[model samples]
Target: MGGVDVVYNPYDRAVNDDPYPVYARMRTEAPLYHNADLGFWALSRHADVSAALTDSALLSSDHGPLLDPGASGPHARTFLSFVAMDPPEHTRMRAAISRAFTPRRVAALEPMIRQIARDHIEPAVERGTFDFARDIAAKVPLDVISELMGVPPAERAGVRRRSDALLRYDPAGQMSDEGVKGILSLGDYYRSIVVERRAAPRDDLVSALVADGELTEDDLVAFLFLLIGAGAETTTHLLCGAWYWAWRNPVQRAAAFGGAIGAWVEESLRYDTPAAGVARRLTRDTEWYGTTVPKDARVWILIASANRDETVFPDPDVYDLGRDTGKAISFGAGRHYCLGGPLARLEGRVVLEELTACVAPDYDIDRSLIRRTVHGNVRGMVSLPTTVKPA
Candidate 1:
């Protein structure tokens, strides 16, 4: 189909529902695809996407990772924080954040996270029928992140409501007015947390940031927004995809219930990565597969496509739990590799373990009720109706 025009528009509703087929065509027909009207070039091949993610010198994230027209340029740092930073600035901020968001800290959260998973999964499993996306997949991760950030339990739902709004897009493919409101509301909410922590410190991430004093108030607020925006949202989507895919591939679901849950989680991540792609600003005119992308051009590193590249993944479409997905760029690569990757993995694994242990191996997904998320960047179900028999 190289002779035919390959349209890879993220804003198209049909493409948002099922981007895999379009991604496959793009990978074969135009590994380095460009859309003049949209003003962005896309890389679908595994090598190109991976190399581009790691090559900060040529591809800068200072423009932000979202495709939102309003989120780029100088304004990015105000809301996107270190994600829109490069080199020394990114390095410095990440270092301070890492010290607070340590492996030990993440490990300490396991019991709380697992408990949160049980709290949600048990209720749904008891009902023997539930919307997996709404009932379990969404609540667990959102609560986990909220708890980590010391958001009061009573306010978590409001936080989630704002988050949903923040990720929503308007008919024009731009951030909707609600999304703009979401940004301001979340920023204000996080800023309040920072202010509170300064007066009366608590045993949470916000308090840690306040004590550290490295990041300014704006930096702290932006970082917290990123944590909830990117970290919580992606994990929720990952869980939703995993639950839906497991029902589709019963054998793998059975295997996961039979003790291969780690493989199940990893494979799900590679098979249906949450963040479809990340946008980068091209720093210089770069040559790729006979095309030269100009400086300052927006580039999309198609992570979902890269994970499914047949050259890298044999029989890329099939969901096989045994497949080695080490090469997958699902979380990203190099400096911008998702800082919350480990925590997300932990959340996924623990939830799956708790879920499969309590519920029967066989569960039915209501195909008619599965509603896909409409955002350009994040892809997954907004609702997945499921019925299960108790173990």
Candidate 2:
């Protein structure tokens, strides 16, 4: 890697397909890499990224989760979920949200999730060929989370379409009018549901938020936006990625079918980390990797790069299911660690188990039809086509 001559653009389609080679150069040539074009810094090493993730005192998340610091400020407080909060504010909201996702609560969903897996997969198998992402990967979490959030199954497609409009994450990327409208549409959609849930008071996440009494009407809708955006979408990508990666590595897929699904899931999380890294703002000038990053600079904590750091993971590029990924921060860590991790893992494990056992021992993914997401902030496949056969 002769000193990464290519300017690292997260939105670049070619780079997104396989970010590891570029990430290797970043970790070696510029651990505290700065992209002046995008006006942000990046920490590529596992040590550096992990430090920044846990350094809540220095790195801030109050603005938004996009890499560009100027993308959205506190003034645009319409969708600041706990992911975009700091300190006592984050603590209060996260604690409240955590209560709604207790381990017991998530575990109880196993039966429902298994049923959902069968409901989606069995049909896809019957069809013999289907786009895995649309038919199954995206459905389980959407159904579970939508139902959990009190949005009826009938409304899920509309919610998904609206939530997708929020792909306008960076100012560097031309913020299309469609994306802006999509964000607004989700806000309006959730606002209606919030009002309904408040009036009727059901035992769902939305009702729980409304009942918490800690959020104003505006905050209530914003929280709903956060729930759908963070919970459903991320888990969908995680499931999609797990399937895609498994297909790419037959040995690993076999191991997953051989009672090593947990290892496979963790390695997939580490190797093909969804959400390459998260955004943060520096509170004060900080010296890192022998350079002084200025105060108030935007930084993309490169968790994707860190997950493959040669220092921490030997032969980091290889997708070895036996590799210990206990230290991986794919779901993040510390204060902002994804509250949805356990639920996401539950979803991933259940789906993989069902696929390998009931759907087919192994099925080849249609590499030509698998379309990947080019979004700068998220690592996800939009489509993964595959043909399946009965067990």
Candidate 3:
């Protein structure tokens, strides 16, 4: 961390594997880091990243919050839905959808979420050996979100498969051909749901959106994609990360298994955030650290890096469950903060609670069989082979 020679490219697979070291160097040497080759700037420090996240007027999300080259510019809303919108439009769409995600609604979902988590983990407990990431972590959140969106049990397997496909990225950091196909398929599928809801409304999000008549069919489809896809995918990674990190730290693992579920979930969110950071488009010239960033440039607010900022959390590398994670920016800030934050947290807590209650506290993971996924924005395990003793 001598000079500001840090080079960070989100598309790089090696970096995504263990980016904390690189993030540490960035926070120390180059808080306002820029990668000319990648054509993006990054803010690694907590204060800077927090400020940029809340400063929506200066740093906009109209171009989407991802680094995917194809999903940029004016048409980003086609894929990102309200997440890519700004100001009044975003406010309107967010407000409309938020009614379904209120604290009471999210709280009511706890029982369903817990039952779903148990359903997934019970089989793993019987098997004694299961890929925690794929078999449990992935399925719980997908089924939860699908249930919320009115996706039938018969169709959920296909939905989860295609949703996963949509997150696959090629070496060039763009969605692969399969990824494109997956998204198109999901769009068609969700559009059909919209039509059915229009015909016979139900007590579900899709039906509610149709009844509200606030969004076009296209908008409804995109919002469903963003909500179901991002919501499930991010929580999947978060669960896997918690499992991996807990295994790495046996002391904290004991605490997690010992009724510190809330603290464990909060720390995991800060430690290994699924969506590393989001990209924002600069609306106008901005000055920072004696330099002026030109308008229209892409600036990435490194939430993962900010969560680990030494200035904010001392001994930031340690995965301690007792640490005060009140300042973590894992779910983001400002008007565009994650609409599913409470849901994600609830899912995480309920899953871990079920895991510990169903499986033995000393369950172990097979490091050799673990598989990791590397996307431009999100990073986590694809498979975590764990062996558990039935509680």
Rank ordering of all candidates by lDDT, starting from the highest: 3, 1, 2
Question: All candidates' lDDT scores?
Answer: 0.86, 0.81, 0.87
Q: Quote each prediction's TM-score.
A: 0.96, 0.94, 0.96
Task: For residues 1-391, write the lDDT of model 2, one tens digit per residue.
Answer: 2355646888787888888899998888877787887788888899888888898989988876776444556743467576788989888877877877899988988998898889998889889999989999888888888878777778888888878756446545456787778878888888888889889999777787788777777777777777777777777788887787777888888887788988878898898888788888789999886789899888899888999998999999898999888888898888988888999999999988888887665787888787877766677887998877787
The runs of at least 3 residues in candidate 2 whose Cα sits more than 4 Å from the true structure, single-residue gaps closed, are 1-6, 68-70, 168-173
Report the C-alpha lDDT of model 3 over 1-391, residue by residue, as the tens digit.
2356788988787898889999998887788888887788889899998999999999999999887666567787886789899989998889888877789888989889988998888888999988898899989999998998999999999887787655775534566677778878988999999999999999888887788877788888889889777888899999998888998999999999999999988999999988898889999988888778899999988999999988989899999999999999999999889999899999999999888887777888899777788777788899899998988
Which residue pairs show collisions in model 3? Answer: none
Cand. 2 TM to true fold? 0.94
- CA lDDT, candidate 2, residue 340: 86
* Residues 41-151 of candidate 1: C-alpha lDDT, one tens digit per residue: 889989888899999999998888877665567677776789899989999899889988788998999999999999999889999889988898889988998998999
The per-prediction tally of clashing pairs is: 0, 0, 0
